[model samples]
Target: MFDSRHIRTFHAVVASGSYSAAARLLGYTQPAITQQMKALERAAGTPLFTRLGRRMQLTEAGESLARHAETILGTLSAAESQLKAYARLRTGRVRLCGFPSANATLVPEALSALAAEHPGVQVELLEGEPPASLRRLERGECDITLAFTYPGLHEEVPDEVVEVRLLEDQLTVLLPTGHALARRRAVHLADLAEERWIAGCPRCRANLLHECAGLGFVPDIRFATDDNLVVQSLVAQGLGVAMMPALVLPSLSLTRVCGRTLEPAARRHISAYVRRDHLRIPATAVVLDMLRQVAANRVGC
Candidate 1:
């Protein structure tokens, strides 16, 4: 029989893609992780990975074993969570994931409150984009993920996952104080077609174009940035206009930029997602309630 620890180490290595990375993530030394993989290979009677330069790739047999390992690990996690359910907030770690904007505005405050109310409960924060956060949640890396949904993107709630809407965030047009539209109370999407735009990313650019096409014309993008703070700073420097969610408005450091709510009330709705398998745990329920309460209080929704 194969040891469960070996199976777990093998899964972590496959998920992380390197022995060193897996070791770091699992809090084990490089040699220990290597030995576990070797033991796993011996138990399975086949090699699991092939080293390619500095990286490692799983073999066909390894991939098949990985699938089974993932299922076994997931089942074990579910079992442990079930056992811990009775403890409620008395103990357990809550892994939370979200983008920087959410981190800036609500995440810290909410986490503080959670810590204060449940001192025995440990909290972990992970920052990333919506797609990445969702992937972490799916991978069991995070217990919960606060993710954003644009206007056209449908809210996808699979049977395995549950999404609770936190807030309906309005989009605001950000412009420098000296810009022509900065003095306006509101701006139409069509009015900015000729103006230079600062996009969030390539995906953001595509999404922006798709949204603006609804208003009759595409934007003239002059810059692209992954950092919203930099985008705001540049807009304050008279760079270009950017549309962003109001939930992140309070975190903007640029005082020279004005945020005007757009017409038709374009918005991104934020949601907290959890694995359906773990939702029944009491600690998970309490944390979810706290998140919902925090959002309702912060946004006054």
Candidate 2:
């Protein structure tokens, strides 16, 4: 257990060739420099200096410690510099996890802005739906997670995390461009009772079943996929109808499908989940703020 302060003092003494000279350079009295040297020798479990004529010289152990001191100090100094830079948001890594829609919409905008503002801060992104991303957040696999819950469902967050509601993502029904309800301003869930359905992720599928059950029928789901493109393609081919968040619709080139807002106005609450301890991290804080701003400026959610 060598003290860094003691190691530094020893290095100074070795550099200056005498305790008195080292003390002068370090702005300490000679006695203080001598005491630090003694402490360093005690930590090393060997005598470091021996009197040679009128001057003190390094013993074998002292020479060994001197040989390694500069490298040790260099590593220590670099570590300190990196920590300071991280504290100032000058350099860091922020890991983010998000669902498909939010990743396609909010995340790209927020991350793009973050890159322009903090280029030294590296970012890693993972795509996972609500409970999955939330699990990653709790386990420390990710620093921040963007997750959402439907109108009829709520996600149970871990006690160690804090959830921040960002926006309301309106659920819209996607219909084939030539379908009878395509041109309608809005469509009722019950109106699609006879149509085959394309389900999304597990949570989205569950939300679909929940909303339909409330309207007195179960969706005849024939295709289950989480890819938004697949959902859009199925609807465009007149194969099935699916509910998608309005926020992601703009990002997709939707020439063959018409997305209408649900007649009952269903919406999901999109939120940012972060471990309580991570809120203090500068890069994570910056990323979280950017997400808020991007969500705030968006048309829906």
Candidate 3:
């Protein structure tokens, strides 16, 4: 059996690139670090490192062991963090990731509540689109991810992730205040067939194209941007019309823009997701609860 201490020592050596540096970092003498490395090699029954002049390089076995060691150490660290969080609920860290609109609106409110409730808990926020955020969550880089899926569109969450639906956000059409369509209660996708459109997000743009195709008209997209503010600005300047989520309106200026719900009532389902196995972590649970509460309050649920 390989001792964790020896493995850790080996990891340190690999990280620092030499036994002497590893010893200094691990609080041991160089000779002791050498002894541990030799013991580790013996346990594996193969040479783990090769000396090239003054530098140490990992052999094939060492490279393999290093990869496994990283995974093992990472899992062990996560377990320790979860255990500590369980023991002391108020004093742990939670990593959260979300898209731009949620980061501007929902995340701020939820994090504010979390901070007020548990001052000792450290919260880290990463901004990303739904797909990237979900990927990060799967990679264990984040504890929770705020994601959305267009209800009737081509979007699906992975089965390994547990999604808790927070609210349904309506997709609204944004037109210049002086535009003819601004007088209508709602605009049909076909009615704006000739109008130049500003599109954002690849999946969202695809959804727009799909919906337009259903109406037998391909929208003439004149501008494309991922930035919601820019999309709103272009629409405000009468450059083009745009489809935006209701959640995004709260963050936009909307001074020269009029927003109306889509005629067919397109909606996106916003939800928070966590790995099934990570749901047991206290910090994750706390943040998830806070997120749900904030979402409910925002949607008046």
Candidate with the greatest TM-score versus the true structure: 2
TM-scores for all predictions: 0.68, 0.94, 0.69
Residue 129, candidate 3: Cα error in Å is 1.4
Point to the candidate with the largest lDDT.
2
What's the lDDT for candidate 2? Answer: 0.90
Q: What is the lDDT of residue 257 in candidate 2?
A: 88
Candidate 3 accuracy as lDDT: 0.86
The full ranking of all candidates by lDDT, starting with the best, is: 2, 3, 1
How would you encode candidate 3's per-residue C-alpha lDDT over 193-239 as one tens digit per residue? Answer: 99999998887788899889888999999988878889988998999
True-vs-predicted CA distance for residue 134, candidate 3, Å: 1.4
lDDT tens per residue, model 1, 64-135: 998899889898998888667557677777788877778787787777787888877777788877777788
Predict model 1's lDDT versus the native: 0.82
Off by over 4 Å in 1: 1-88, 155-157, 201-203, 298-301
Give me candidate 1's TM-score against the actual structure: 0.68
Window of ten residues with lowest summed lDDT in model 2: 150-159
